[model samples]
Target chain A: MPSTYSRTDLYAEVQQFYARQMQLLDGGAFEAYAETFTEDGEFRHTPGREPARTRAGISAELHEFHKRFDDDPVQRRHWFGMMNLEPQDDDTIRATVYALVVTTRPGGKPAIAPSCVVYDVLVWEDGELFNRSRRVEHDQLFGSAAAAS
Target chain B: MPSTYSRTDLYAEVQQFYARQMQLLDGGAFEAYAETFTEDGEFRHTPGREPARTRAGISAELHEFHKRFDDDPVQRRHWFGMMNLEPQDDDTIRATVYALVVTTRPGGKPAIAPSCVVYDVLVWEDGELFNRSRRVEHDQLFGSAAAAS
Candidate 1:
């Protein structure tokens, strides 16, 4: 079927997708968050490290990664903006967005972690958008570590 | 003329408008930033203070506000997300978005100022979107001084 979704529609859908996805991650719903991606989706959070492939792998990696903050009262909120969406001819959409992770603690000021640029490849499955792949580049580590990859 | 833009189109346009508007403000182009609003635009940055009315007033206020950072190496970036756009029957759009100001100083960590929720009434004039009025609610000051306003 020819794609009926306009550019504007795609933009809105993609933004909504990220909002929900980040919420699930920050809320510690690892399994549900993993479901937002394809079965064999790949996520590369670190440049020099290998990507966490497959839904199970993604969930497990995130689960371990977030364990350190479990004992802390800090709340992490992911905010995404300046998104650019490009639809490809192969029924896939490329989305690039700037991400800021805000950490706030009770009775203290909020802090911003290192900024990142995320590149996501999304596909439509059963009338829903799913991330097929995601690569995150940390702005502060662009030269030293990211260049090593 | 009846509105031809779809809900999705309006969302995309509003997001892009903010992206450009914030860039101009962070870049210290106060005159250009004020021009993005209507001639009689009202901006209330503080809850207990009177809003700055008119484009000229807005420009002057921002210019004086940013002067303190002239000698500092800190760069402030305004990031907005989680926008809710409602189109009114009278050809106006109401936008509510979460705003975060990230301040980065040279050779130091990035910090987040108090987060805010921005409410804006927008209208179309000369085929472009312009803010008619803006009211900012600081998240950290929800019950303290905001209650007095």
Candidate 2:
């Protein structure tokens, strides 16, 4: 950890990283989105559901997720807010944020989807922040009627 | 903002603060939980919902919330994970974490309740950390069928 990173520059950078990740995911850019994670990144959608533990696995899970909902008119949007980063002993940083996932159908107003808590362990490699692991504490919105994505 | 705070002590302190907050809230220690916040702390359960800005108001809100579910067999539990802290220019810090609120009914098994993002602004006052504000970005679980407690 650098001594000079105790200010707001690091905060701004972490915020931008989350904003970019949301944009890419919402824009249906899977490959580009996967690049944001480390080559050996991991993503746990829910506690019991399958976890994507590799870059390729994460990419495939997201691809299949979007594809499953392709025909549905509900447009999913992830809005992340209030990101805070804690520096680790090495170059790794852990970021935690509130995620508001909204869904809008063609004829209806936007409704709050299954929002979640985004826990990300990010690593600094090659002068860039890459996600080492992401765990989503999903809001099972409608209980049994809805499942984790 | 001290030169020595750049090390791991601050990080550990912030994490312990969060852990203590959770323990207080879950232990039914309302006074202690309310004391964790500043005198003028604020809590936003929803974007438009009324926020509790005063210490008394915060205590009342939480009291009412738990009271409503007192008779129910479901025991509400808040499991917080991956707390990250961002230091402000002043001495205030922003902490974000992934929160999983679960409930287990007497006859039913444990089920996940609505999980959301918990964004907390913490300030150090009088040699102790206090919560300045807490913003919960709910996924609007079950739409308007359920409200924040």
Candidate 3:
């Protein structure tokens, strides 16, 4: 590992990196976001579900997903809060947070969806940050059923 | 870091932790599940809302939330997907996920309430996990119109 940052610095780094990723997603920078991981990194979804186990696999999946969905005119803004961080030996970290994602369809008002709980396991290698594992714990779902009915 | 696990092992750990947390929530072990964080951990709600900045605060908030609404007899299962993780130096990590939470009302069957997105920042210390930050990005309120009406 390079130099270790203080808690405040570490938290700031984490927050900025996170914010940048979200910005990339909202700005349609899908490929840039995919490149953030290490060559052998993995991206897992739900705990029990199948995961993209390799960097290549994750990249390909992201590419495919963007190809299929990025063109939508709907606006998506990912909002996150309650960040928790801990130092694992000086190089790895385990963190969790709650998130609420808002997607506004064109010409429609925004809505408050249910909350989601997320867990992340991360490692720093070769001076760049890469995700070793990520688990998303979902919570309440807010608005869909009644609208459909 | 003690020893770097293979990508597969990391993914496995992520899955295991995710499953454990979910199982606890499903089994109504809310307090136990909340204990997953460090003493000074945080639980944040998104869309520019306030977050519980301490473990005790978050725990108390959840306890009250589940308790107050527990008698409502709503059985909820959170379905999570579209997860991504980022390494933020050593001892800290960041992640985001897409989620769909389904709430099954008593004898009403299961339905998708609303879809949401979450972002998490976590830390690992002493071989344990902790949350540093969380943000919720709510998409839409499903039953709000009817409730308002």
lDDT of 1 by residue, B1-149 (tens): 12687776887888878876886786689999999989999998767678988999999989887789877756576888899988888989888989887776544566778699999999999779999999998888887765777
Model 1 / residue B133 / CA error / Å: 15
Q: Count the backbone clashes (under 3 Å) in each candidate.
A: 0, 0, 40
Q: For candidate 3, write residues A6-121 as lDDT tens digits.
A: 45455556667778876876677756766665666666544455777665687676666556555667776866544566668867877675555677888897764544556777
Query: Distance (Å) between predicted and true CA of B5, model 1?
Result: 1.6
Candidate 3 or 1, higher DockQ: 1
- The TM-score values for the models, in the order shown, are 0.61, 0.58, 0.50
lDDT of 1 by residue, A1-149 (tens): 12687766777788788999999988989999999999999998766678998999999999888888878989899878877676788989887677888889999888778666688999999889999999996655543442366
What TM-score does prediction 1 earn? 0.61
lDDT of 1 at B126: 77
The DockQ of each candidate is 0.18, 0.09, 0.05
Best by DockQ: 1
Worst 10 residues of 1 chain A by lDDT: A139-148
Deviating ranges (above 4 Å) for candidate 1: A142-149, B1-3, B17-77, B81-107, B112-149
> RMSD to native for every prediction?
6.0, 9.3, 12.8
